[model samples]
Target: MSTNRELLFKYRKEGISDAVIYFALEECNGFDHLLLSQNLDKDIKDENRFVDAMNHYINGEMIEYVFNKAYFLSKHFYVDNNVLIPRQETEQLVLNSAKLIREMFGDKPIKIADVCTGSGAIGISIADVFKNNKVVLTDISNEALSVAKKNGEGLNNVSYLQGDMLEPLIKNDEKLDVILCNPPYIEDIKTIDEKTWKQEPHLALIAMPCTLFYEKVLKDFRRIMNEKYLLAFEIGEDMEEALTKLVKQYCEDAEFYFEKDMYDKTRFLYIKSANSYTNN
Candidate 1:
């Protein structure tokens, strides 16, 4: 029988970070750290679960997937292998969109759509924050949509649509005040690490030509978007110049801006129609 400290030391020696080890323990035991401290030398009760989680981590599996839950905007969202795990950087998308909605819509009910909504983290979090706004979460994969829907089960204002980008909106004649997307921007699937390639869904990770979805949306944007609309995207850093060109060609009347993430890398795109924005 191995003691908790001994097992943790083994994991540490295998290059598992302290944060990941601690998170795994907390997830398994649910914050009984005092007992954990006193019983450092005691045999762990559910040692097999810990072993399995650590083994998965050692094999390059994401901790969030091991726990089957991810935290976004300070809320816990259910996640699975079927969908991409929520990322910390995407929280900015929720924040930026929410702020713009409040400032632009100003208490009026607004329609928003989150295209390529994986796990519903972006759309659902925005809907959760803006209680008065209705959000439609759309994805091309039915499996991904199922995960998104599960995460949004408690929210009344959130709906799910399965389709490619804005196609469902165009088919349904739905017009939106805001459209947010975190589409597949990885230009090469080979560039992804082996663990990610094996564990995550390929459809959600690879975007051949890299800008296909963005280009598609821009071409058909007029069909589903209102006169005054905001388009927010989580883009790859390498996409800034090309995306700027796309905006110039298609969004001639829109003001486009690229925002930097915490590392100062340009990773977010914000395009707002010039004619629609009037200071309230």
Candidate 2:
């Protein structure tokens, strides 16, 4: 049986990063990096599974999908090829939205929806934080929703709906105080790397013109949103001008702005209704 240290050295020699190797070892063996490091001489738990996971990684599968898990806002979410993996920028979206929610609504219970919710990461994370708020997650893909449902299993404040964008909310007569979305915003499929293009779901990617989903939701915003509400989106870095135009076209009287992620990229778009409260 190969010991943990031996496997680590083996994979590291084969060009895998320590981060990937540690992640795989932790997932398959239930030992985090610290524990694995401390017990390097111990035989790996489920060595076959670890090897299989490494094989999948070597073959170009995303490490998150290889293990069916992803971390967002420091919370673990079940993920698969059916949904786009949660990203750091999207975590920024959630954090900023959460902070704004507290600043805007305080402890008052509000209805929140994460449209185009893949893996239920955004909605589930927000629901976990704001236990007083009600969160609804909507995804067009049933398979994706299944993964989301699995991640959302314990959250009492979270619910799942399957539909394209905001249609399910409209049909269900759900009016939300805050709508958060990380829709498919890539215009050119060619811009994505070969590994991502091959491994991730195109339905959650490849939005022609990049603003396709944004336009759809903005066009029908009134149908699903309350009179006083906030709309947030994870946008492409280059989309500020076009999305500004799109938001103005649909929400002429609303206040909206673009926010930068940790990497300083303009990656989030936030729109507030004319009646919504502002700290200023």
Candidate 3:
């Protein structure tokens, strides 16, 4: 086996990016180049410690697991195999939901529920923005709940529950003012990229189909949503037409329909229940 010293030299010569270098330092425990290149103005020799770090990196010990940190807005949250890593798309869901809340309610405190609250990313972010508003974060997995519990512990006006999405809200008698979800929307699990399918939690990323959860949410809204409640959901790619059909079928009188995160392939949909109620 080549010595760590020789390996370090080769990787540095290859010129790896800073991010990969960061993981190399993190996963390898220590890189020999930085550790060994201590002399002021002394240029390290070719095929030095840096090369070894990159070699170890490509051999793949550093990425044995998924990324452990997820950044949302200003803060960082811890994630692991048991919890689905929060994605930028889900963050968009939260931001768009908050915007709808402000547009409809004008800064007033309202009850909000975030279903399938993995890592508590969506709910925590929404709660952070609406300081006075209350948020209930719900999930079915205890492992996922544990992650949310830690992420949400110090956030003001945030609540955590371990149960199926709507079940916990039913027990709490919360007819929410807003309901936001990034539920498992992929209908055919095989259709997703192999890398993501392997890395993410299936329970958190897969469901009967793209529109399945929306159908279930329709039932949930019928049971728990009130005239004043607003519902927002993140849909799979190209799912707006089908999801819109479902919403129109069930929520015919909703005041207006809006799409958020327009930059994304599939945007989130917000239906204003109060608008529907008032239109009657």
Candidate 4:
């Protein structure tokens, strides 16, 4: 059994980032940051598992997938290749949705849906924060939904439905106060990096013309939406023009706008019921 300090020195020589190495070590060894700092001479119990994780990382697997965990909105989510790993930009979408939810309906009990919820990250985060609200997580893939179910284990306010986007809601005659989505919006798989294209699930990444899913959602927006509602989407950076056109065509009476991410890329689309806009 090698001491933690010796294991760290050996892996650090592999040129991996200190953050990545530390994260892998802590997760594999069940060591918190304080434990890691205070007990460098402690023996690593599962050195082989740590080595395997490092090998996966070195072979272009994202650390999130290698560890089967992703952090979104300060919550840890279980993830696998079956689901798309949550991204930082998606975290922004969650933040924006929460902010708008509070702004539009403070302390009002509401129903929220995370359409195409991959790991249930967005909906689970919202449900965790807004205990008064009901959250529905819908996904098309059973395998993906299984991963989401694991991530949502402790939340009493969340329900998981397996179906195509919005179909479950429509079938159930469910009307929601807020609808948040981060659907697959990639225009061309070839454009994505080799590692992502090869490793990430394509069903969660690629869509023909990139705006197809958005159009599908917008075309049927009113069918499953409450009279006063908000719909938010995490869109591809290049999708503003096409999505703006779709929203205008399908939701002419709605108030909608495109928002930029921290990088100043047009990465979010928001549409609100006309009455909601007037009330706010």
Candidate 5:
């Protein structure tokens, strides 16, 4: 009820939406200025704690990481320093997955795999909707796997694994019906990508040298993916051409799709297995 101006300075870059902060303050009941400042580790005590927090966030610490949470598929998801913040555009990926599930398997239970499962957002959201379906969450980083486990702690019919690309998934014997991946596709664009991307964990965003993660995942797909499966991925707008080319390496019969997000950004990729689905 204060609406104090001092509170506004706490968030400069608008790193988080105002509504989320307000909701967190109300539901969590811990938005005291003094407590926020004192407990906000290394976040400056100046007029711009927001900027200070941003810097630490770049270094990968939680700060007022206190109020950090996201709503995916109309449900709340808790995220912290170890996890990459879920993007609004990612909801499209989940929606597309749900649509595919409904289309292919109808109301019957199906199997799905979410690769590069950061915080388990996509898989968890999908699993929440298709409660009877089996959803497997896979991530390479132990820290990220821990975050995913936390996100999906109580969910039934979901499994978690830690391994590279398609490595962990082989344990399933390649019977997964759907493969959902938001792999690191932000290929190194020497100039533009550096300025905004330096903030996230290099491991989560970068895909090593010349090979982007999406390409690797797809190339491996022809070998690892089930004969009757679909793969959906969150993609970089400018990199779709590059991605299509990557998908071709393994399966020329693959279907390429451009999914537009809320901001009208083409932020998603969909590929139907050649052995599974006809071009549609």
Candidate 6:
């Protein structure tokens, strides 16, 4: 005997966003005008699912995880605790990476890899956008790879590999024109909100030395890089100076570019050697 307004109020009281509450309600029960109308407060019939969903939300479970699917670039991607939830900021990563791919490689065939490809959101979304590119999605966790594979189903241009970063690519003798990664760049897990930290996979969120994985990618995986390689990362906002030093140590000649997110945080890094590609 719960009215829609009551349910909405309940969710808002628990600090859930109106959009997320709406999404949860819609997923639980199809939207009805009476449900959203202030004047027509009536008990919702058979809203057990809605009640359960609300409980989950109130308990700090991410709405996307509750739904088991997330919308990325207008596509639905399967997700769970095995992977990190896709964020709007990462959509920017996809958009810019797609633009760069088109600019550097044209419409011709190209090889790319998505490292730390949780839920296959980045690699799958990229492949869906750039049809001519063959993308290999790599994750160290088998469970994460399984989740990614489910999201990547029916995408013929995508392949899955289970190894840390570019290790699978190196073993397969694959050289890529681009390598994109949303690595674990969090220097301290304690800094994150308890609610979110409880729900997301810790391995996908925290890195011991923060730049440990990034450093490994630049140093050990240099063999699998193509002539006109583009290396991009969704970086921690404060990693510019540290990453700059690492880039100098491992890839001193590569041109480095940093991109700010909508909040003006330094959120991305683009490293490439245009001169090598142009000369060749």
Best of the candidates, TM-score: 2
Question: In candidate 5, what are the lDDT values of residues 1-280, reduced to their tens digit?
Answer: 2232334445434575555444433333344445544544432234244444445544654333544566666876777666777777888788877887677667656788899888789999998889998999998888888888888988888899899888777755656778898887655656435423544456677655434677667666656555667888887777667766777776677666778888887788777755443333
Candidate 1, residues 38-77: lDDT per residue as tens digits? 7777776677888899888887789889999787887888
Residue lDDT tens for model 3, 153-266: 778799888887688888877777788888888777678886567666888877776777778777667677656778888777778788778887887877546465657475
In the range 1-280, model 4's lDDT, one tens digit per residue, is 7877887888789888887888887887888778887877888868889889989898888888888887787778999898988888888888989999998888889999999998988999999999999999999999999998999998899998999888888998997889999999888766899878787888999888788888878878689877889999999988888887888898888888889988999999999888784453
- Stretches of candidate 1 above 4 Å error? 1-10, 32-45
Measured on C-alpha atoms, candidate 1 has an lDDT of: 0.86
Global Cα RMSD, each model? 2.6, 1.9, 6.1, 1.9, 6.6, 3.1
Highest lDDT model number: 2
Give me the runs in candidate 2 sitting further than 4 Å from their true place: 278-280
lDDT score, candidate 6: 0.84
Local accuracy by lDDT, each model: 0.86, 0.89, 0.70, 0.88, 0.69, 0.84
Question: Arrange candidates by TM-score, highest first: which order?
Answer: 2, 4, 1, 6, 3, 5
Residue-level lDDT for 95 in candidate 1: 94
For model 2, the local distance difference test gives 0.89
lDDT string, candidate 6, 1-280, tens digits: 7776688897788788888877766666555334545332556544798788778877778889988978788887888888888888999999998888777777778889999999888999898988878999999999999999998888899999998777788899997888999999887877998867888898898887999999989996579987678888999989999999998898877888899999999999988865734633
What TM-score goes with each of the models? Answer: 0.90, 0.94, 0.76, 0.93, 0.75, 0.90
Steric clash pairs (candidate 2): none
Better of 1 and 5 by TM-score: 1
Q: Total clashing residue pairs per candidate?
A: 0, 0, 15, 0, 0, 0
Residue 212, model 2, lDDT = 89
In candidate 1, where is summed lDDT lowest over 10 consecutive residues?
26-35
Kindly indicate the candidate among 2 and 4 with the higher TM-score.
2
At residue 224, candidate 5 shows an lDDT of 59
